[model samples]
Structure formats: C-alpha cells, structure tokens
Target: MTEIHPTAIVEDGAVIGENVRIGPYSIVGPDVKLADGVTLEAHVAVAGHTSIGAGSHIFPFASIGHKPQDLKFAGEVTELIIGANNQIREHVTMNPGTEGGGGVTRVGDNCLFMVGAHVGHDCQVGNHAILANNATLAGHVELADFVILGGLSAVRQWSRIGTGAIVGGMTGVEFDVIPYGSVIGDRARLAGLNLIGLKRKNLPREQIHALRAAYRALFENEEGTLRSRAEALAAEQSDQPLVKTVTDFILEKDDRRFCTPRSED
Candidate 1:
C-alpha cells in the first residue's frame, strides 16, 4: 500500500515499495528507489541514482541524490547508496559520487543527518553516525561507526573520522581521527580518548583501562617519535582491539596527518 499525493510527481521509472508514503509536492526521479516503509515529507526532491532504504524517513526540503558539486563532474553515472533507517532532516543535501571517487557515496544504516547537514560527493558514512545541525563533510571524508560531529562542525576532504570519535561543535577537522578519540577546538585537536563513549558502549572496565594507559604512553610520553611510540603501544596492547585501533590508526600512512593534542593540553 503506497500513498503518493496528487501533487507529488513520481517519474514513471521510479520504484516505489509497499507501504511507502510520498507527501505533497514531492518529486521522485526516474532512477530513484524508495524502499518499504520509507516516508518522504512534503516538498522533498529525490533525483539521480539514489536509493532510500527501508524504514528511512526524510523530512521537508531535502535534496537527495543530486549531482556531485565537484567542478570536475561531467555527466558520469554515479550513485548515492543510503542504507536502512536513516533520518535525513530538513534542508539536508546528499550528493551522489563522482567517477574518480569509486562511483559511489555509501552511507550505512541508522545514520542521523540533522537539519542543514550536507554530505558531499563520495563520502563513506558508517552505521549510527550523527551529524548535528549544520555539520558538513567535504568530499571524500570517511566517518566510521558511531562517529559524532557536533553542531556547525566541518570535516576536510579526505579526512577520516574513526569509530566512536566525537568532534566538538564549531570544529574544523583537517586530519584523521583515531577510534574512540575525542577532539575539540576551532581547529580540531585531539583532547583525549572518548571515555564516555566507551562507557556508553558498556565495554569492560579493564579494556577501557588498557586503552587509557596506551593513550598516555603514546601521546603524553616525551621519549620518542609519535610513530615509534604508536608501534610499541600497538605491540604491547595487541590483544585489545580497542587499544590497537588507536595505535594502528596512528601508524597508517596517509596524505593527511592524524589530529594531535595542543602543546598546552
């Protein structure tokens, strides 16, 4: 039982699933696919090769699956693949991928894109990610599971936000963030491990303790280079993936540097 409003324009080739609801004045393009239980409120426009997964709810005026904003885009076939149960809020814009960015922008299940949020071309967003009001990701950013970006924050292109990491409000993230890391500042700097996030996840206390110790050994110590310290730390705490995730993230080679704490902090 699909409900499409009289003023809503669903193109002939669009795929509408059972129990889907398209509200007044909405437009669904020929290539769009709305899965079962999907709801699009009034004045929404879904275009390009986009697929709204089952149980996803999109509020008013969202521009989903639009063409990539990249200056280099030139009519290539790309897709925006959104997973199930996503909540895309008002004025949010999620663009499709470009050819150079692997031809797809993929978002995992249960992500929350708050009002005025924007997901640029070729971004990869993992499950349970949260982008607070006006948070924006530049093209090609990767956000791991449970990553939280606070209000008015912006992530630089090609930056990777690791699992359970939290970016504070008004921050500008220009580099990679380790798993469970907490970063804050106008220009983002690593503050410490996301202890609260770990606790919320109900991770064992001992594991949390190991991760904290490793964090101190890597960042607080003054003996050697950060990379060397990360290597030793990773080896020492190899048994705990929680600790190793931070170390391994530090050791990985990338164009951008990992966020580090300020000298005063």
Candidate 2:
C-alpha cells in the first residue's frame, strides 16, 4: 500500500504504485506516475506529464517536470522521463521538454543530482552521471554516460559533454567537451585525459597509455594541425580503444565550439 501524508494533494489522474510515499505539502499533478518504491519528500511538486521510475527518491523542496522555462514554450504536451535509482537532492529543479527541441527531457538511471542542480528543458542525461551542487545545464544540453559536472559549473545550451568527461567547479562550458578529458575555468581549458577516472573504471593500462599518447599528439604536439596529428597517431595506434575515442571526438565536431589550448602564434 502507498503511504501519503494527509496534507499532500495527489490529483485524480496521478498514478502511485505500491510502496510509494508522498510527503507533507507535496503536489502530485495529473498525468504524473510514480513507480514502485518511489518517494517524494516534503514540499515537492511534480507536475506535467512526468513519470518517475522505481526506487527513485526526490528530496525536499524539489520541483520537477515543470513547464519549460524557455520564452518560446507554447504549452505543448511535453514530457519528463526519469529512470530508476536516481538520487535527486534538495532544491533541485528539472524541467520538461519544449516543442523546439523534440518535446522531451530524459534522465537515465543511477544518476546523482546534488543540491540546487538544475537541468533545463530538452536535456538528455545519460546513466551514472553526477551533477554536483549548483551545477546548471541550459536547454538542449546532452550529457553522455559517466560525465561529472563539478559544483557551480554551467553548461550553455546545445552543448554536449562527452562520456567520462569532467568539468571543474565554477567552470563555464560553451562547447562540446572531449571524451575522457577535463575542463576548468571560465573559458574552459582542456586539462588532458581523465586518467584517474579511467583507472577507477578498470580500463586497462595499455588503453590508458594510448589515450595519454593520443592526447599529447592532438593537444600538446606542435608538429601540425590537431586533425593531422590525430590522423598520424591513429595510423600508428589504430588498435587502441582510446585512440578510437580520440578520433571519434575530433571527427564528431559540428557546430559546437571546442576549447583548444592558447597558441602563441
């Protein structure tokens, strides 16, 4: 049986699964569905056509699935879909999608969103990602699996944070971050591969070595253009998985700006 506090308002169309808990002064809006083992702490507001997966816990004062904050939002039928085992901390705000950006904001499983984190409309966050306290992602941001954003970091709209990348605290990211790299500061600088993170994930030593070499060739080598150096390195280290990751990252650039090291020329 579900346990709901007396002061909470669960709309008629809201579906609460077995073992779910709704706390005091919370509002579960119409068309919202909470799967089994979900819990909403006090003063939470879950609105719109939102669905929370099993074992997801939302802390107190969190506002989720609200209408997109974009000025162009026209009340279209958008949705916010959050996967299972996510830890949404206190005072967090996650908005639903907008018509301009495909109409859905999706958060994958086992992610941790710390206090005061904000995920704006149309964002797609992958599994095992961590958004630290006060980290903010603007509309249409894409965070790949295992990406970590430090406290107070802000990513601009339409930016893509690659898999395993780390954004340092208080950084302002306006471009696509390379996979396995680290970025820091206002105009973010590429601080090389996230070697420690890769090791913790059990990636082999050879792969790490290849990645370190590739990173040096692309960013540190003064021999040629980044693309040319990457191509040359790939010719010699084609078998390395890290080489492939680096090649794919360089080739995947479209309109998104990437931070490059400051050249004296």
Candidate 3:
C-alpha cells in the first residue's frame, strides 16, 4: 500500500515499505529505504545510504542523509540511520557519517527535530531528544536520552550531552554536559539540575532532591576536583539513581571540559 505522488521521483532501486507515502516532487535515492508508515511530505529529499525507521514523519524541505559537510569527505559509502517515530520538521538537515567518523550517523527513537535544526555527521542522538528551532549539533556529538536543546542553541563538536539535560535557548555549549544538568549562558554554564524535565517524567520528589544535592556537591562545593567530588559521591550509598547517573557521567572517561557553574564570588 505504498503511495507515491505522480510528480515524485523514487529511484528504481529504492526500497519503500508498506503504507509509506511519498509526496509531490520528493526524491528518494536508489539506496534509500523508507520503512513502514513513513511519510515524506512534499519537496523532501532523502539521499545517500539512508534508512528511516518505521512511522517517522519527515516534513517538507528536509534534507536527510545528505553528504557530510566535512571537507575530508571523499564519496565513501556512508550511512544515516534514523530511528522510529521521529518528527523531522521543515528545512532540517541531517547528514551521514564520513570515513573519519565510523561511516554512520544514528538517531534514536521519538526525537523531534524542529525547523532548521541540523544533526551533523556521526552525531549519536538518544531517544526522547528534542532539538528546538535552529538548534545544531556539530560532528561526532552525542546526546543521551531525554536531552532537550532549546531554540537557537548550538553544541560544539564532539561534546556529549547527558540524559535529562536541558540546554537553554541561544546558548553555545563547548563542553560535555552532565546528566540532569540545566545549562544557560552566552557560552553554556551549568545552571542547575533540570528539575522541570525530571518532574515531567513524574520522578519522585525525594529522588529529585537527592539529584539537586549531588549537583551542589559536585559543582559548588569548593573541596575537590569535579571527578574527585563525583567519585566521593559515588562512594555514598544513596537510594536515588539519578544522583548516581550524574556522578557516573562525571566519572566517565572524556577529556572534554565539563560545563560548570560560573563563579558566584
């Protein structure tokens, strides 16, 4: 039951799944595969080795699986794999991986990429992520589950955003953000825990309190280095899993700078 508009151009070798809709003037390349219930609205261009998962709705003017913007890309066989039930909005651009970045870009399920958002080559986006209008991720960036990037925010290359983090609008993130961290600044600085996001998940109040305590200890306590503070927190026996999530994220082996609170004094 695949439906293709009369004006659409689906290449001869394209593999379109059942109940997929290809709209007016859209182009599906030979190596592209649209899974079950995928809807490609008018003027969408899906090129390169791209396979969009089932039930994803790609809006008009979206450029999926396009060539990587990296100058080092040399026409290698790369891929962009988008997960299920994503909402890709108008003018969003998602590029495939280059040889330098393991040759594949992966986006997890239930993502909402807003208008003009860009997912750069080899970026790994986890489930329940939301990129607001004009939000951008540079090459090889990683976003964990429940991460939200506000409108006009941009994450620098190779930074990792942890689960339950919220990046504020117009912020430029140059460092790795810890889980449940709320960041906002001209250049992103740790604001606090993402309490709104945690509450939206219906997380228990005590658990959130524990996370907040851990945040203060790790970022505000003028005792030890961030990793040392995190390690000390990890040694504590706590019933709150979210606290451990933040601590473990800090303890992870990444050389990137950790986003921290601006000096209050």
Worst 10 residues of 1 by lDDT: 256-265
RMSD list, candidates in order:
1.7, 1.9, 1.7
Top lDDT model: 3
lDDT tens digits, residues 172-235, model 3? Answer: 9999999989999989999888888899999988888888888888877888677778888999
Q: Estimated TM-score per prediction?
A: 0.97, 0.94, 0.97
- Screening candidate 2 with a backbone cut-off below 3 angstroms (N, C-alpha, C), the clashing residue pairs are none
Candidate 1 lDDT, 104-135, residue by residue in tens: 99999999999999999999999999999999
Residue 149 of model 1 has an lDDT of: 97
* lDDT of candidates 1 onward, in order: 0.92, 0.89, 0.93
lDDT of 2 by residue, 1-265 (tens): 7999999999999989999999999999999999999999999999999999999999999999999899999899999999999999999999999999999999999999999999999999999999999999999999999999999999999988888999999999877788888999886778777877899999888889878878877787787766667678767887897788767776666434575555311
